[model samples]
Target: MTTTTQYPECCAKDNGDALGMNATATSPISVDGTPVAGELYTIPPRCGRAVKLKKGQVIKIINTPGSQVCDTWFFNSDDLSEFASMEHTRAFIDKIIPQPGDVLVTNQRRAIVTLLTDTSPGVHDTMIAACDLFRYSNMGITEYHDSCADNMRMALNAIGLRAREVPQPLNLWMNTPVNPDYTISWLPTVSAPGDYVEIRAERDCVAVMSACPQDIVPINGCSPKEIQFTVAG
Candidate 1:
């Protein structure tokens, strides 16, 4: 398993703010990085982890196991009606071809988070499900370490949010390959320890994430690892 350390500092801002400061918190919450055995965290094949944040507080989820997927979603606490609609955001952000630097707009038409950094530079499907025992068995993957619902669930419980609806999640560090029939294959990740994708909060949005517990295939492999959520100054 890989350990995540040596977090780089973010001293710049892109929201047209003059400070251009990093979204470090005054009292940042640090949760123990624990790995669940057979849970995929939230969704059967997808889940959402949680973390409280300020409008400009920058949150970074470091992938310790490197290639493991950190599936996530962000919602508004004010009304909860306005949230990250994946299809809408995808269409609004990228009408034709989705690229970096596009803003993930919320249902209220607010800018949630700008696609700041994409380290993988490969395919990460928002359409894939989190791992689960049922799907694992159905897919003929029955070694018993397989799970897609591990981390995202834990995050929601830890942060005191009730499970409402499972929306489309952003798959972080997961590798997907497009075949001839337009089917995407989940391949191993292209990252190692210390390599991560960072996004600054465009608004004070609540984020849910799962450090994927998928063991069905070698994507996350058998040994699941830890990650870091640092709000630095």
Candidate 2:
């Protein structure tokens, strides 16, 4: 029997659709996305969460297993259209993987967040697009699959918000290194358990983090895991 999936009302718009479900759609850190200062939260495996950070507030994301990749995005709380853009950030920082003290910029070329600390080997990816239903379909999976793109959308919907597009995420702990020939290889994360990174908000913004569920590749060690985070001034 063929079945049709019904997405949430918030996804009625053209770009707000989510191809699958996870706890991300039902769970939110807070109603308005305001996170409690210094309170730790978890984005369950294959899920995501959205948290609001005021300008100057810092968010620390922990890699509990050291093998999971967190696809993260920052959006101007006042304007969802303005979001962290990897293309613009690389131009601004002159590096593919932003290190501590580098600033992340929005598509508008405005500073959004600043990388404050990276306890890992500074191995991250700004070149890969977030996994989505189409990605899974291309891999021969006809069934619904959880995706970072969907997680980002659902996480925002849980907070009573939505974005017209799913911006390229800052894939934390994703060890896809670029070779001299400009080719990239997807490798397992090199970070140790408990490793983390901190980024300070350059402006009041909503940050969404997805515990990437790309098991088809070894980027997450072929085993997805949860991601922990905390926000503080």
Candidate 3:
């Protein structure tokens, strides 16, 4: 029997409040000066939202104020099994040496999400997973709102994936300090305002992302910032 549990994946149009944030519309972009606001969108933090995008439409996820890790995931709308796997992502995408425009393809060599832009340019850590309340207090944070954990669980359950399998989240605005020996230190914000990463999914993908509600972690340790989304029809 295919057992399904009540999980936290129904984050469609949440107005973010936990992180002192909100999502507003930015000026629409144009294809050769003809605005395609119907096809593209910019997703903000603390809330998880999904936009149905078609072929050739580009979606941009910006670290609005910069240096905030936007936790993201994507699943094949038809087959969630061949989903976004960090281990498969790292192993196949030359994790030992990732760079700009590098396609983090699936085991089938199909494009998942492209690295259109990266601000904190260096060894990006795909191994370090997303941490939550249970792990936070143990890491010295006594009290923190369970935002990251909530959104992650939501994304997993939304697509029929199990919450326990929530894997390493792709840190869109995080920068890690690399020692001479390649040891990583989850460093502070290296991203400035308006730094964005663009992606055009090759196949129909049900994508989910969270503006991490991690006040305890240094990724957004100082505070949570806002994010914006402008969708093209």
Choose the strongest candidate by TM-score: 2
Q: Candidate 1: where are CA atoms >4 Å away?
A: 1-49, 95-99, 132-134, 140-150
| Model 2, residue pairs in steric clash | none
State which candidate, 1 or 3, has the greater TM-score: 3
| lDDT (C-alpha, whole model) for all candidates | 0.54, 0.92, 0.55
| TM-scores of all predicted structures | 0.68, 0.93, 0.69
Tens-digit lDDT string for candidate 2 (67-150):
999999999999999999999999999998999999999999999999999999889999999998878777766788899999
CA-RMSD of model 3 = 8.4
Across 1-233, the per-residue lDDT of candidate 3 in tens digits comes to 23332233333444221221123111112211232464444444565544444545556776777766776666665665555666677777766435677766654557776665555443345666665544555655544344554565544444344333454566666666567998877667776777766676667665556777666547776576665544332
Off by over 4 Å in 2: 1-13
Per-residue lDDT tens digits of candidate 1, residues 43-78?
Answer: 222233466556766666666556667766777756
lDDT (C-alpha) at residue 116 in model 3: 58
Stretches of candidate 3 off by over 4 Å are 1-45, 96-98, 107-109, 118-124, 140-144, 155-164, 181-183, 231-233
Clashes of each: 23, 0, 14
**How much is the lDDT of residue 37 in candidate 3?**
66
Worst 10 residues of 1 by lDDT: 16-25
